[model samples]
Target: MERLLRIENVTQKFGGLTALNNVNMHVDKGEIVGIIGPNGSGKTTMFNIITGIYRPTEGQVLYQDEPITGMEPYLISRKGLARTFQNIRLFSRMTAFDNVVIGMHARTKTNMCDIVLHLPRKRREEKECEERAMELLKLVDLYDVRYELASSLSYGHQRRLEIARALATGAEILLLDEPAAGMNEQETDELLQIIRRIKELKKTVILIDHDMKFVMNICERLYVLNYGVLIADGTPEEISKNQDVIDAYLGEDDE
Candidate 1:
């Protein structure tokens, strides 16, 4: 399998505190990988470094073998990498369709002048953007509520809409942060199906979630972090039995 992303000796620090220390991991093309760790274990820090929200204090991030470390977040996004925050960050005032259309703006080619003049190119691109946004909405199973205000949707639908918006960015790799954070069992099951569909669409995904069942069920491989260090990397079955992982995150269950 081709390596789509590589984090080489990545480290992050804030003042005198080290958030990530010599972390190394890789994600293959078309694979759904999971990053699991307890809170403050540097999972989000790792995502920030990968997505260019924060430059690593040391080390590098590579996408398709090209170094992307220190690149601006928007540039990284335009390079086909996009992410959703742990907390919902939708355009609450906008309609679901409009929120997705905003994401399409990054790939849009129509210039300011074209839009100012209401040129034919602008009209054509606008039409295409709406079409694409609607297509993504359907892909995430939110087409029926496409015209509803994003703030009005249920928490589960809001999460799905956020994924649709991320898809609108034309991302080949999606970094989903706690996508199942507040979802109930039914919503989580629906999310699982959506993730499978995303995989079928040939998109690589890296997710951080506390839902062990959800993560373990969907991710082909898992990387475990503890106290800013990678403690284990393996399949779900292997991780489930790994002593270090069990000690750090999954406490001993009553026998």
Candidate 2:
């Protein structure tokens, strides 16, 4: 399998505190990988490093064999990497359709002159964006509510909308932070199906979530983190039995 993303011995520091220490991980093309760790274990910090929110103090991040460390977030996004925050980020006033269309900004080629003159090129691109936006909305099961304001959607729907917007960015790799954070059982089931559909689209996914069942069921492989360190990585079955991962999550028994 081809490696699509890699974190090579990454270390992140702020002032005197180390958020990530010598962490190494990788994701292959078309694979759904999960990063599971308790809170404050540097999971979000790792995502930030991958997305260029912070440059690693040591080592580097590579995408498709090219170093992407320290690159601007937008630049990295333009290179086909995009992410959703742990908190929902959306245009509260904008319709769902429009919110998704806005996410395609990086893919648009219309210049000021093209828009000012209303050229055929602009019209063609506008049509394409609208069509793609609808396609994505449907993929995430939001087609019926495409005209609703993002703020009016349910929490689970809002999370799915975020996924749609990320897909709108033409991202080959989608990083989702805590996607199942507040979802109920039914909503989480829906999310699982939605993610399977995304996988069918041949997109790679790297997600951080605290729901172990959801993570194990959806992810083909998992990476475990504890106290800024990578403790273990393997298939769900292996990880379930790994002592380090067991200790990290459930603590060692005194008995």
Candidate 3:
């Protein structure tokens, strides 16, 4: 498999506290990896650092086998790395279509001269962006809600909208934070289908989620973290029966 991302001995600190300690991970092309841990295990912090929300205090982050550490979030996004927040951070006042179109803004090339002159290339570019936004919305089955305000949609729909927006940014690697949060069984099942579709569409996915069943049901590999370091890396079945993992979560060696 082709290498897509790699994290080598990354350490992150916040004032007197250490959030991540000597972490190492990698994601191969076209793979779905699940990250799981107890709260305060640095799961979100790792995502933030990788996506350029925060620079690591030490170590390196490589994307497509090239150094990408400390780069700006927008730059990373433009490089085909996009992320969804643990909390939905949509433009609440904007329509779903508009929200998605905004994600493509960094990639849309239109000069002031072209805008003032109403040049065909500029018009076509904007039109193509809009069409692509719509296509992404359609992919998540949110086309009917295209004109609705994102805040007015149900939780599941909003989550799907976020994914659509990420897709609109032309992400080759998607970092999803708790994709199954606040979802019912049916909604979770739908999300599973959507995730599979995204993989089929050839985007690599790395997600942090608490739902064990959801993670085991879809992810190709699972990484377990506790405190600030990785404790296990294996298939679901291997993780399921691991004594250390059981001890970490249950305070006992036997599961």
For model 3 the local lDDT of residue 105 reads 81
Model 2 ranges with Cα > 4 A deviation: 252-255
Clashes of 1: 0
What TM-score fits each model? 0.95, 0.97, 0.95
Ranking by TM-score: 2, 3, 1
What is each predicted model's overall lDDT from 0 to 1?
A: 0.92, 0.93, 0.90
Worst 10 residues of 2 by lDDT: 246-255
Which 10-residue window of candidate 3 scores lowest in summed lDDT?
246-255
Candidate 2: the clashing residue pairs are none
List the candidate numbers ranked by lDDT, top first: 2, 1, 3
Clashes of 2: 0
User: CA shift at 124, candidate 1, in angstroms?
Assistant: 2.3
Clashing pairs in 1: none
* lDDT for each residue of candidate 3 in 1-255, tens digit (9 for 90 to 100): 899999999999999889888999999999999998877888999999999999999999999888999999899889889999999999999999999998888778777987888788888898899889988888898999999999899999999999998888889999999989989999999999999999999999999986678999999998888888889989999988988777777752322
Best by lDDT: 2
